[model samples]
Target: MIGFLWETFKIKCLGGLREEVAREVRRHLRTNSAIRNVPQPFGYRMLKRFYGKGGLLSFLLRYAGLYAIIMLGCAAIVSLFPNWVPKSGLNSDRLPDVQNVTSYFLAAQAVMIGLLFPVALGVISLITQREDASSTVSDLQVYYSESFAFGVGASGIALSIVLAIHVFWPAGYVLEYLGFSDAGTYFEVVLLIAHLLWLLVNFAALWYFLVTSLSFMRPAQRALMRRRYAALTAIPDYLTVHLLNHRYIVRLAAEIAKKVGWDKAKTALLFGGRLERGEVELNNKALSGQVLSNVWQKPLMWVIRRWLKRCNKVEGAVGSQPDLDFCPDFRRPLSDDGIICRRIGGIPLDKIERFVVGQSFRFKAKKP
Candidate 1:
């Protein structure tokens, strides 16, 4: 009885955990549409679609143009105030004094915070007007845009604090008290450090936004593809079309592979089996000496056999295969003139079915 319970726990309990995780992932994908609809940055799709002609020019106009306008506008504002703009460049023998450095930093921060308002508004507009209504104008989108604005705004404020400490903290007085004669050199070092810090902070903010945006969008894209696949399947007589298309067949094959583990499903199809009865009869000839000539391969074969054993023992262990009602003809025998007999994308449907529905040939695994 103990052995029986332990066996059940390994086959059933662990399998249940795996199923729960997959279901949660699917649930997240189904509900989170913002991830799917967020725009890709850097005009990546545009570049791909229109590579040779004006793609580069178009990208620059759309993205870089706005960036340049913001930056140049800030510079223009600073240039207007000759007193605020630093007269001496970083390479000059006499570095800009603390007052000049502070002035320039304040001017840049003002422009950055000012630019964020319009950018946030644009993000909101983009989210609310997306073609997929399901993904648009949700609380998540509002939060995403608002959070981005807040983060960028906060970063600008933080830059101000850093600059204040690095510039006006009297580092020269402290260096002189420490017996350093070159106060200008020490002040120059402090200014250089402040500039580097400012650049670092801005770069970090940009990187954070890019990474989070991409991460949010990737799962949404996968979910969208799954929805598309589901829609394609809903069309009557689409199975044959899917089987006929190399791309569709490959995609369908991958989905089925995930549903039933590749090795177990492949074995069931190749050797033929009645999984419900916990007996997967193997073709001895298929596992002949020629296939097992390499001694190292024997361990892998043993592992495969063990996995198949556990799979058979587990009740309702088919990974994610849909109900029979959904695909009534999934594993049905091919008619003499049926499309299954025809070669698709260089492989016959009969051969493809072996991996996809081979395990479902005899009995459906009880749905857990």
Candidate 2:
């Protein structure tokens, strides 16, 4: 009885899931004018483009909330510090002493550096994740190695220029007129400026590295093909179902779906959507699939990809000639008319391949 009940529950769950998926697919088909015209994911963009829409206002609010929580915790820890480190009785920096002024300046600089370290680390980590797929301890080493090299090089160049102005030209002479009489004071100002410049250089380097690195993630030849295919393919039925299940995103998706046509809007939605789950099929039979899997995984991924490639080639030569031209690019025709074309250029390639090769062909025509 218990087993029967469990089985019944499982059946109901799957049925409900399928029904939900179908409803979303049908809804997009009906309401999204551009759906049929555009590719997947972008058509789904109806769901997840809020960050683009809201811009700085939403970003500020998001970061502000994070800052508030961090500051609150910082306040608690700061409160505890006074109890741990008691006030000194010594008059090292006595009242009204010049030494006190210097000490205060040092304390302020120390505090600033303390605050800046974590901020720098966080920025570096976030930028690295956006730009680099390397996630191991070695990733950190590489990040720091590059970062240090860049920082030192930048600082050296900047210091050299500033030194030329101060030493070779006698810009240091002009500083005397500006009431920075002491050479030490002038040097300190230059040092501070150099520090600020170095910080800016670090940020610039990070941004540059991030953009360039992520761009290389895709193979040069495949990027355009993948994009074209993606546009043609459109989002799968499942993603639309997943997005509409989220209340806020559903409203956003509906609005975008109105203008971009259902397909483009859906494509956009999926691009922006926060994916809760994902799965990848590793099929070396598809060269592109094998390449992608190898790029994403370990030696095992490479081995599986190579094996699949060999099998695909063998299977392809054995298949009937009719099946050879299956999955021909019929996007232009498919877009121009709602009709799904099976034959390529009036040739019954699929049937010919099957009949001649006398083997099971896995490739199907790119149509329903």
Candidate 3:
């Protein structure tokens, strides 16, 4: 009796789960716009075109051009007069203290470098096919955002306390009590601390800007953005699911149904009575015997099986031809689309052959 109850409960749970999955699938199909008509961003379109046909040399040239532009802008800014620098600390007519100016420059550079470094690392890692780099880059964004906010808040509070002490109490007397021999040393220490605080503030402000901008996006838009980011940054493990064919998706659904302990007939219904190869054949004796013992259930099951067979015939007819024309320009040796063509157009054939041979030799050598 206990075993029978457990089996019944399991069957109900599986049925409920299948219903939920079918509902989500129907919802997605209804809401998603026609694929060809979906508007894409200019930047994404440009990237797709570039990666489609651009070689390694083109990639290097593109980044080099960007680097040159950034360097030129930095040089132009640094050539300005010293007086242009903000006078937050002290008003001195003489050329601002070299140490203080240099410290400020270093702090500013550190903030910019810290923000850009992770993005560059992620791009390079994607090109080199490193999954670990993608994970690191994702974590870096979260870490920097949180750390910057906390550091700036703590530094601001500390600075406020110190200023209050200097304004109300005798700061010089306090310094003397602490055994500071010279005013220059004390001022230099204060200058260093100020630069550190400035750096933290800059980082936190930029991070807040990023967060604020992203917060404006709707939940669905944000999810789509993250999915695209993940696809671009990591090797495509499930690329076939996005291709023009529905057979692969159907087969995947069938496998999932089997894993969840669905019997053959229920699995067939889930997949519209069709496997990847052909229609599933039902055992008449089993269906009429123990499986459909109730007289009412027998008729309902017969209708369901007939409906599944019709759906399978429709699906088979629709999938008889290739769904989309294969574009030559978008081929990559490691991608599913490229596998069908067996060629990488932009890259040199000799280089491709040499890389394949080298990989094969290495594999053979690794085998005992």
Candidate 4:
């Protein structure tokens, strides 16, 4: 029993870690895809189809919330350390009474972590929406516009501060190693300038990374995180798209298309022509051939097809032959009714789940 429990615990832990890794992978993929599409001018115009203009106040409130939550989290963690926050400020050098103050602070931290963590996560999730929604445009516009510029400016300022701090409060060992004994004026200035430039470049890289991270967040959430942390604000939208596309939706779409048919537009329209122009001509020729090749097939197919042709029903045929398998994929058209068409023909019942069925293959409703 103990061994069994141990094995079960290990499996659960592994599952949790796997989820975390998958999440990270998805984030990175979304970022990369966003970056690749950045240079395409017309794409931005196309993105407008996704959403309307975003409001400023709602956006501000989101970030403000994020800032408050993070600060609260920090406060919680710090509260645990008695030395950091004493029960009283009079004895700065001495640690706070561990027994007296620790329990209260720890309890407060626990409550804050429990309450704020979920709220922060929800706000953060909005900041970086994974779903294809209207909000994407507003989020994207901010990252490419003011947020990105702010990152660059902030990075520059940070770099300058790092340089000043490093140079003015120079460590004696580092200065002496560089052969600057407070005598070599010109050489020291050159070294300082070089070091400053290096620092500036590093800061810029850091800024880019941060701004990109913000891409995953909603504009309001990003704003709040930025207000609180003063970190990067840019995010790679492509990465999110890419991750989601591959890991979930698009992959499923592709699999369904491959199983049923490649002509997405034609399938979507529930029409005869293929999606691509060349394929349309080819499909037309094939239809003509299908009519001629088996004169009895269409009539037989038509008779069998009529069973499920009612206002709300499914219809199809079953055959071992390859071509007749096409009709099996079809079903009665969908309308105002809440029903979805379902049928299985040449394929086994177990395998039918993989194929899309309905009026339009793309508008799949259920497992059938």
Ranking by TM-score: 1, 4, 2, 3
Worst 10 residues of 4 by lDDT: 277-286
Enumerate clash totals for all models, in the order shown: 0, 41, 0, 24
Model 3 agreement with the true structure over 1-368: per-residue lDDT tens digits: 44346444533433322223334444554464553234455744533443333334543444345434433333343345324433322222322353445445464645565554464455335434645555555544433332233333333333333333333224333334544312323343444454455455445544543452344134464445445444433213223223212332344344443443324432332321211232212212211111110111122233333433443456452233211111111111112211111211121123343233222111011112
User: 51-168, model 2: which lDDT tens digit per residue?
Assistant: 1123334434443454344334433433554353223222222222433433444444344344434644664566467654554344443333322323333333433343333233
| Cα RMSD to the true fold for all candidates | 21.7, 26.0, 25.8, 22.7
Error of 2 at 94 (Å): 17
lDDT (Cα atoms) of all candidates against the true structure: 0.39, 0.34, 0.35, 0.33
**Worst 10-residue stretch by lDDT in candidate 2?**
288-297
Could you give me the TM-score of model 2 versus the true structure?
0.20
Better of 1 and 3 by TM-score: 1
Judged by whole-model lDDT over C-alpha atoms, candidate 2 comes out at 0.34
Worst-scoring 10-residue span by lDDT in model 1: 288-297
Ordering by lDDT: 1, 3, 2, 4
Models 1 onward score TM values of 0.28, 0.20, 0.19, 0.21
Residue 322 displacement in candidate 3 (angstroms): 75
Off by over 4 Å in 2: 1-54, 85-238, 241-368
